[model samples]
Target: DQTSKTSYDLVVIGARWTGAVGEYWRSKTTYEVIKTIQPPVLVAIGEREQLKRFLVCTGGKEFIEQAVQFTGRLAAAVNASVTLLHVMAEPPAVYADMVRLEENVDQLLESKSELGTNLRRQKRELERLRVSADVRLRHGIVIDQVFEEAREGDYDLIVTGTSQARGLLRHYIMGDLTRSILNRAIVPVLVARAGPAKPGRTLWKAIKGLVRTR
Candidate 1:
């Protein structure tokens, strides 16, 4: 495939509001293109100015490092400020009793928790790249927190990472966080996927499924 054959620095795509409209009427082309493409995709929305402030939402996932590095490089190139944000959403059942969502950034960074360590490491990495960044903490719904930070910070771009999900139906029916941000973001969103390249066969299968469901 062309994606496998050639290296890409970034893929820019447009985003729009489709939530009010029925899912069946929504175009699948954007989601499909984002899924198949390997490069970091920038879903541009609304009006934008010269790229400056960047709000990077980090979840300490496998792709977080890659996404942070990507944003760091971009920020370094443009001399933009970056704020690393992690929302303390409701914990899963495994850690629901133990995890607290109200800890401040200073407290989180000082603790020995995995999230704390990852935040500190990412900040150091950004500094190593000669990019200045501040770590911020939030609580409540992940997407809502992100939107709040973006507006309050007046950020130029939002950087995020996504974990791979199998099959197009999952992407279509249960849209992932990154895609959700893309669809609703007022500013541009940069999404980086880390893992093996999604095979062409999977794309074909997903397309077939889309057709069958339609």
Candidate 2:
């Protein structure tokens, strides 16, 4: 007997860094991060279908595997695709310096060699992950680019990491990228806790386990 496939249910945005890390570290394992969020149930049962998509916004190799895992699981259950976006926001001066360094590669052979090696490593990683993904890198402000992509791509959901606000004034003002994105995003947003782990019972439990083992 052929099992019927479940319809697509959700779309997840910003899967690369914060969302990936949060999903990996969270104790709950059943949650599926997709590119969009659909109603829990549809009117038609057998013929009903929902196409979910997940957009992963990444800058580097950090937490990419976790994002892929989440997307793969969701896609297996329902038709879905993972889109990876990389934003390079280095200032124009930095870009010029890189250009100059490239031009002087013969003069600075050692330094240029190291830089080339690092760039190759990054490219290799990106290539490996991009095998099953739509990957693109752009240069601009991260939040602006993310918002623009979401709008242009017609994403339905956004998953992102959120860091705790520091300082009384800043906290009150919500003067942070996470807050800015949350405020401006038109679709549903999942804000993952991106702060340092709090020292709590888990620490004590680990200490006790060590003591017992000793």
Indicate which candidate wins on TM-score: 1
CA RMSD of each candidate after superposition = 10.5, 13.8
- Report the poorest 10 consecutive residues by lDDT, candidate 2: 39-48
Best by lDDT: 1
TM-score, one value per model:
0.74, 0.43
**Candidate 2 structure, TM-score to reference:** 0.43
Clashing pairs in 2: 10-36, 11-34, 11-35, 11-36, 11-37, 12-34, 12-35, 35-53, 35-54
- Candidate 1 residue-wise lDDT, 1-214, digit = tens: 4656889898887755545652222258667767666677777766686888999988854346877888899999999988998888766778754555335677777778888888888898999999988998877899999999998999999887765665653321223677678766777777766542235578889899999998
Tens digit per residue, CA lDDT, model 2, 39-154: 12111111113445545554333333433444445444555555555556656774787655554523333353643443334334434544334544455788898888877877
